[model samples]
Target: MLNKDTLLRIGCFLREQTGKVAVYGLKLNAQAVYWHFPKSIACFLDRDINSGFFCGLPIRRIEDLPRNNIHAIVIAASLSAESHIYARICDFCDSHGIVIYSLYSGKLKAECLGKAFPAEENQESELRKAIASHDIVSFDIFDTLLMRKVLFPTDVFDIVEKRLREHGIDIPGFKNYRIQAERGDKRHKGLAGIYLTLAEMLGWTDSQAALVMREELAAERQVLVPRPGMGEILSYAHDIGKYVLLVSDMYLQPEFLQEVLAENQLTAYDELYVSDDRGTGKGEQLFELVRKEHPAETYLHIGDNAIMDGWSARVHGFDSWLVPSALQILKTTEAANILSFAENFNDRLLIGLFANRTFGNPFAVREKLVSVKSLPQFASFFLAPLAAQYVLWLLQRAKIHHFEGVLFAARDGWLFNRLYQAAAEIMKLPNVPPGMYFYGSRKLCISAALQEEKALEWLKGHLVGQTHHFLRECFGFLPGDGHIPPAWGEDTDLIWNEVVDKKESIFARSAVIKDGYERYVARLGLKREGRYAFADLCSQGTTQCALTHSVLPNLYGLFFARYMSGSSVTMGRVETFLPQADWHMLANNALEFIFSSPEPSAASVDENGNIIFEEEDRSDKELKLLDEAQEAIEKFCHEFFSLCESDGFISPAIGHFLLSMYQQPIFAGAGKVFDGMDINDNLMGVRVDCLLTNEK
Candidate 1:
């Protein structure tokens, strides 16, 4: 294990050397060093090398390879075997005049490189300069001006395949077959020609082939989004009175491409040149067509392909600006390490969605390696998937159980209810139980349940360490009310005898609270005898117990997680979607706060059926941030539900792993999302300030 200082010194030394450098080991330590200095390090050398590669670098044997122009060899080994590895490599280093450094040593032979994943060059300014100098500005459509929400263009086939199977068209190996269909005799075939090949392979009629082609196009419409700031670049070219042309080596027709452009508000181009319309592509002929039709004093072409857009365009007498694609930029950063864990189809889909959003802005690397611009982007990347998974589980569970309706508990349930309704509609699933936001909280529900025998026990456990204001809030009393003595306002243990004395008074006040809630529940219009279920965050079934015992009997509870210590009467009616082991490992406060509503917690209800909310402790900026985050989560859920089928659902393990990455300090700028945020629990008299600040 190399310490940070040691790694820093070694990286600086390796980067400063002009000649080639090689690591001695071929394991994780070597991979880590390669990531830190990918361009600086040449290759890896080992005694047992068999012509393998690590991190795209070739592996070589020291005895078989020539040592000309070799600079240094760093022993990327554990501390226990560092001395032995150093001794084995020192003789070769001395003969070759190569300096050998230990992974554990703090001193090294050279200077430090500044950032982990620095930009290869300043290209954005150069691109703007080229656009300004040229009369005609040409752009590549795919991965340049426009980007797909998925990682690869062909991932669209996976989505189409999932949709096909959902509609009872389960063809095995459909995605691979679709890929091969396009890769047939001609490489630049149009949509119709590719589907004709698919029809021949699958023994389908022309109509069936056309249906499948339309499915692919629909999938494209769902997954396509504008690359961040590229639209502005195109508009800038147009504003300067330059003729802008969009070119792409794609099978989609020019008309459909225009519609896609218009849909994303990218309508500043003079013309679109598609490969399918001309049977030629940007490799050679598309640029020739672009030049022949639209002559200009000086032409500039901007694209992502190095060979097709740069060299090929230069051959056609046009200057080119080659920008890196989203995938190209993401592969250089720690995102590669994060994405290595994606082993399944669903996992890759999620990674693709995240890649589309996080890397869409090409200049994100200028500020930080992995840039989360705001709280909303943080929510979309880390929080939305977990929230969607919970909703997906609920959708399946509702169908299996045949529940009459779902009652989402207030505050936390506000987001869940909206997500549930949206997902249900998008999936087009039949017989889905109606989900509604139920305005009830622990404070309000526990007040209604004080008459029950176990309510006293619950109160003792939750309110013992709380202040008197919290006690009043729990029992439906307002601050500054003359209901209790002033000395009781301090942080004091709840004396059972003293509570007994106030029991009559508390019950008398709580009666109006119970009546107000009863009227509110009646207004929901759900049948009293229906098999209704309650949806909530982490709980021990207190809300469920109160609702079932007081207002609505025979109510079932569906929780993200449950943490009861002993057996209870509501055990059979309750089911925890998240397992205990997974629940404790997560930051439950963050989850609750991220998915929570901006509205204050429900404190109590008056006799006239008006709900009294807790004092709003959150600042207006905090409220605005929550609203933005909720919108981002909703957008992600909408996209996920629209594209992904219920089959091969996102696993809980993957969801947990993505969330842990956000909560940890692995990504730069993640802590900025929660920098000054606080979570207040008025009923418990607890406030978590600057939560999840990445203090380690």
Candidate 2:
């Protein structure tokens, strides 16, 4: 898989270069270079950096590299994604006067290699023509009428192995044995024979094999969903009064397949033909049995397989229509290489979930559209996993650190808190820190910490524009007449100096803000001496710094990510879920959008312990999208945590992969949900565009 010969050539080329060398991608192809020629490479570069090091070499972002530090950059991505990655970074490398090289031969592989099925439109068109001309229309069951969520049919064995391990049936290499048994035994004996062979191979008792068999069936039932596009064609055939049949060259029991079909509501078929039942596979004699049963009828056979459903059916004198399987169709898109990189259970689960959600129709990614039709569905498949993993990591860390409580800081924290609560309950985590929504923000925290010198410095740093915008937005107070400068450029320094000039007024306001927060915390049942953790989407620890200076000295900061290394006060007191490498993938504002609440931002607190809020700058439509997206995320978390037996650890590499795929402009329909949305820094009076905006 590494193409060792190509790697050796690249290694020799790298050794011949004079200056520093860096590999441009963090996949296996790139790691191969570091492993073989450790002395030749200086560093690694990747847009989606999940770790600080790969094979003992430091990883650096292209933009972070100093001038003349590296003489050449070598690309190590797969050929499918290699071109796009090359184009993306080539200009930057050229501008920096760095040469570009590739570990690959720079040749593009044929797009649809091997015995891939026909294109979706062509297959559908041919099926319609055949249905009109033929009296009987037979369809292949799996991958044609119904689709499974996993990447491959064999992946079910992996799931079964995991489930068995969960139930204390730790059979090492169970998946390998399961595959060997299915392929080693007679094909016509069905599921029982496969299990029988597995028992003999593994020395499993008959009852033990039966229990595993039940689990395999359950996994199949759980992963299967109807292929909607093909289902439409099946319905049309039945509506036109043509005789229909469901055919499959599968070792599964016909009764089980029938039950699954009924569960999927595929009732248009007149008969079913199974290879196991007839003691012959489709490419051999199963089609002949079907022909004998329904003699002298013009037949059209539609399936995802080119051989079993096409050539074999034509040999039996029936017309054939070939539609590519979801995996085959996936090969035509950029995700083909990424999906191929999944080698472990968790990695495969993430890939399977993505493929199941996007490639079920096989034609879904053909147009490369980034417009999302269903916000809820997009949230479930795209946004939810990453968000859930962040909170799950927070919960696990909280338990490990033995924190007394967690304060989910207001606004975006509202969603994070909800997800945390839902996941903790589902996981049944014991002694999980009590999490509550704390009405705190940068403005409120800065106001509470005005007396602190560091807090004053942070406030001054934010004064790049009009002072009135700062005063009204940050403190909910208007500036006086002299504070409004005659010219636009003159006010920032003038107003900031004026604010420092009024120390007595600042003291009074700081007292009021601190008192308001103290009362609010009391009402939430959090004590001043309690070790409460503040959860935020991301920050440079300004909130935590301010809190430690003015109040809540026992508080800790738990962030999803930090844009940069934090201030000195938060050195040991703060934690982040994302590694330093992933800090660049999602902006802090984008994180706020996904982890958002419908309520307006908390501007400051009233004297009576109520939360004073900024104006609802978001339109009603934006609010609805936020509500739907968050709800979808919550639902996804509940379902995912309920079924998955994770230790609250999702590999950052897999997280990086999902995030990287989602960020691509061509990835299916992801841009639609975040389109036209704005991420508002209510305290700073700055509005940044959503990450996925401007794609259209």
lDDT scores for all predictions? 0.73, 0.71
Error of 1 at 75 (Å): 36
TM-score, cand. 1: 0.73
How do all models score by TM-score?
Answer: 0.73, 0.75
Q: What is the lDDT of candidate 2?
A: 0.71
Best by TM-score: 2
Predicted structure 2, TM vs. truth: 0.75
lDDT of 2 by residue, 384-493 (tens): 76776777778877887888898888887998888888888876777899888887787787778776545566665643454446555454443466333321233466
